[model samples]
Target chain A: MKRPFQNLVYLYILAGLSLTIFLVHCGLKALTVTVPAQAQVDERVTFVMHSGAEPRIEEPGTYTTQLLAGIMVPKSWNAREQAVLTYTSPKGNGTLRMIPDSEIEPVSGVSWHQAAKNMFGIGPNLVDDFEWIIYRSTQSYTFSNNEDIDFNVQVACNVGSENMLVRLGFYVGSSIENLRPEDDQYKKFTFSDVFEVSGGEGDVQDFVNPQLGTIQPVRSLDNDIITLVFNGGVMNTVLDGLNEVYLRAQAFDSDGQLIAEVMEQNDKTKMGSIGGRQFRIDIWPRGFFAIEKGKQIARLEYFFTNADGTKTVGYGNTEEPFRYTFRCE
Target chain B: MKIKQLLLFAFVAFGYLFHASCEDEMANVVTDEPVKNITGSWKVVQLTRNGEDLSQRLNLTDFRIDFKEDGSYILANELPFVLVGSGAYTLNDPQYPFSVLMTADGESEQIAVKLQYPVVNGKRQLSLSFSLGCAGNTYQYNFEREN
Candidate 1:
């Protein structure tokens, strides 16, 4: 009788151990995106995304879902047309297409493009005009119960016409699950090392490092409103630790003649602090300068100054003012 | 004779009620709402691009749009706008306008602009949203009645 009772207890212990193994670890276990440290403009750069995930069957049933990937690049790249994505896993292998701006993310309730933007905005980059081009798998995989899967994706995109250093970003998020799954563990993201694209257009735009001044809509007419950002914390400077800062700028006409200038550190020219050491000001050239009807503004030469105008910061942290050209293609 | 008189009375009452209802239907109009009043100079109180606010960075205080009582508008210190200088303007459904149609001084074609009129902080506000150079970049300008 003792032998039989001992056997029954042993059987119960074995069953518990099997259930524990079946449960396993659930969700995105690990992920990494690999890309070359440097590439030339208009050159095709390959980015390899290797990811592992284990699905936990909360209930007894089969489910169908597709994977999705979001890749961030400069808006000038026209990535929607230039980038191509392909994936291979135990589930299947197929090419991915740019999920139209209309395709909605199941969990986020927003377009995949927008969802990616909301998830990571530039990812520590200083430049403002960046786009997250989202791609969706062409095939769906079926799964039931505890299962382990691995995916390897190949992404190729041509660099845009710009000489710059920027960190690329990648995000793998919420699959097209036909059933319930953990929302948090399904998302993983990473930013690559400073990517250098040389022999491109214009001057070298540094996004990895902070700067004294930056402007948006790199190309715009005088008729459009423009934003100028003064980064005081870029490095040691006169206005580095000051709590208050102001902008003193001169607007020039097409012929390089100074048309209007505002050097007052009053309420109108005071810069609004955007947390940290960054400040911003928006100016409509037509209104700010009050230019005549037929004349057009050529550019703006400006500098940052502290209250009472004792300390000033200019181009290359020198006494020379920073110059920004106003043009539109 | 009494029975005949009672039948005549019933018929007369029914005819009188029917005629009264017809008259009511013909005179049922009671228009109450007046045309939306937007005759004032406005300036850009807020500006946005692709839904990102840039009010602090752009100097929009001098930009002005004057909507005169003569159904004409004049633009001063203009930004990217559909019609420039002065133009003849008209409202769609004057009583409850959802848009304003403007024909520039030289052009005959009409450009319809979506208008949002709201009163906040006890002051009337005019909001206009448009895409000037690229359809991808949208600019919204909100203007409050300039004191």
Candidate 2:
């Protein structure tokens, strides 16, 4: 009878051992098998220029493999945790978002602050209201090799009144300063990060003429007249024909697609003509032409020659080239 | 005999539970669901200057617009030129109409819209306009709802 009891105990011990092994294997398999749930990333790329002394430019930076592609955050992550990365380009600055183990989708039409919180952080004040647009990548690329990629991101934000008036200046340590025509340092820099914007034309003339000082558009058509009217008081030297002037036009479709380009010259000989030769102008399609109907036009950039013979460019008001569609028969 | 069997079953169940809980602790990364409102390809159908149709072509994508509902908006082009603008905006109620009041590139100028017509399914046909320097223009636009 005692021997039978011992046999029973032995059988129980064996069964328990086998069960432990089986369960351990199952747990290990579960841990090894990674199943990424349904995930989506919406990437919006904005080319931004820093105003003030720094005149900083921001562009999209490199990403790590550990950083997931989409902007969605997992439900398990704390609202404060964020994977924030910043990249600086010659033209501007770029910010990339990394969300760890999250399942929450980013909110639409909200400010950048709200979006950043949802993507990787539960923490407040992590996002700057000055920056908007959350962007994502489509084709997956391996970050293992540290490859630099320029992901084409797009989205339309209001071209506020401030930027509406074309800013005429140069970048100084990643910041923009109100350019003075006579300033020698101002003549060295050029325009960059040309993008399409959706906003009311701010101060088209607010952009100072590189040749003449304090410029404004006089009786102009963004679609028809590409004029850069310079006031007499700003810098009378260009009007006196003492200096040469050059105008460069870069055009893009409404969706921010580059369309046509023209660079024309209006030197000292041509300066004294228009009282001020206000339209240090550049014309496309020769004589006169209208945009083909049903076609969408975007950006228009202008660059001018400074007194020292160097150049300074200004961008025109960016608008949708889509023709008016409201006509009652 | 019955007690013994019960004990054996209990032991097995406890082992399974312990293992399963441990698995949850690993770096289980997963993909998130697609966003609802701002997803998919969006075509630029309207361009306005102070509310007037400047009559130009401006076709671009959400990628082109530099708009990600999650962050600030930046619009820039290829080279030799770039401008940075930023501001806040929200989709106003009468949710069906889908109105948005936005300040562009940090400018004080305000833009407001009220959809009037339909462009695509789940999208609203709207009239949008902006104000600056006592001079403002209005235009009609077609915006689709995100699928």
Runs in model 1 with CA error above 4 Å?
A: A1-26, A104-110, A175-182, A217-219, A240-244, A252-260, A263-267, A306-311, A327-329, B1-46, B54-86, B90-100, B106-127, B132-136, B142-147
Per-candidate interface DockQ score: 0.17, 0.03
- Per-residue lDDT of model 1, residues A158-221, tens digit only: 8887888999888775465311233456677788889999987687878888877998766666
TM-score of chain B of 1: 0.75
Per-candidate count of clashing residue pairs (backbone under 3 Å)? 9, 95
Give candidate 2's error at residue A21 in angstroms. Answer: 99
Provide the lowest-lDDT 10-residue window in model 2 chain A: A26-35
lDDT of 2 by residue, B12-44 (tens): 999999888768855474545432243232334
* TM values, all candidates: 0.73, 0.22
List the candidate 2 regions with Cα displacement exceeding 4 Å.
A1-329, B1-41, B49-63, B66-87, B94-98, B103-117, B120-127, B131-147
Q: What is the C-alpha local distance difference test score of candidate 1?
A: 0.79
- The candidate scoring highest on lDDT is 1
